[model samples]
Target: MNDEDHYCENCDMDLYGISPIYVDYMDLPYCSIDCLAERNTYKKYKTIEEANREAEKNRYRKEEK
Candidate 1:
């Protein structure tokens, strides 16, 4: 397990000591499959092509308040 507090790219939960699930675009690491699914849902996309088409939009949508 990585000692660094690598948080879930989706929910931003601390992902210490847990295995990470990485995506391809930015190689972002997620905490779990559920978190990965939630992220895709948040992007309102089921395919990488669609997500890439509006990557900026998804990025803006997931920005921290």
Candidate 2:
């Protein structure tokens, strides 16, 4: 795969060559992931614990049913 051959589904640029990233359901495509990771590494999402702390800050469940 060559970057010149395939564009990143995100930035529309030929990135990572033409290697199509595998995205699971609810996961991001190559473009979004690349952007989140600053374009030089894989994207990183918050851990469960980290998410809990962020969500627990002076906040009630917004729409949890």
Candidate 3:
């Protein structure tokens, strides 16, 4: 997606200029780890590292399939 399309799913904030933009397991963008956690109530992630670990696991599983 282009810069115009990069926005946080939770707050709808522009993510184009933001460095280290957070993304969920589903590849949805967020302005911060807090916003990522807020949007994904089903998953409990205390930090970005936790979220990234889960995402990496899921990615491997998908690739294996």
lDDT score, candidate 3: 0.72
Q: Ten consecutive residues with minimal summed lDDT in candidate 2? A: 36-45
lDDT of 2 by residue, 1-65 (tens): 44353555446665453445635663334544545344333233246455557557636666553
Ranking, lDDT, top scorer first = 1, 3, 2
lDDT of 3 by residue, 9-60 (tens): 7888888767535464555667888776676753578776777898999999
TM-score of each: 0.53, 0.28, 0.47
TM-score of 1: 0.53
Q: Where does the lowest 10-residue lDDT sum fall in candidate 1?
A: 1-10
Alpha-carbon deviation at 23 in model 3, angstroms: 3.5
Q: Tell me, what's the RMSD of every candidate?
A: 11.5, 8.8, 8.7
Model 3 CA deviation exceeding 4 Å by range = 1-5, 42-65
What's the CA error at residue 58 for candidate 2, in Å? 12
List the pairs of residues colliding in candidate 3: none
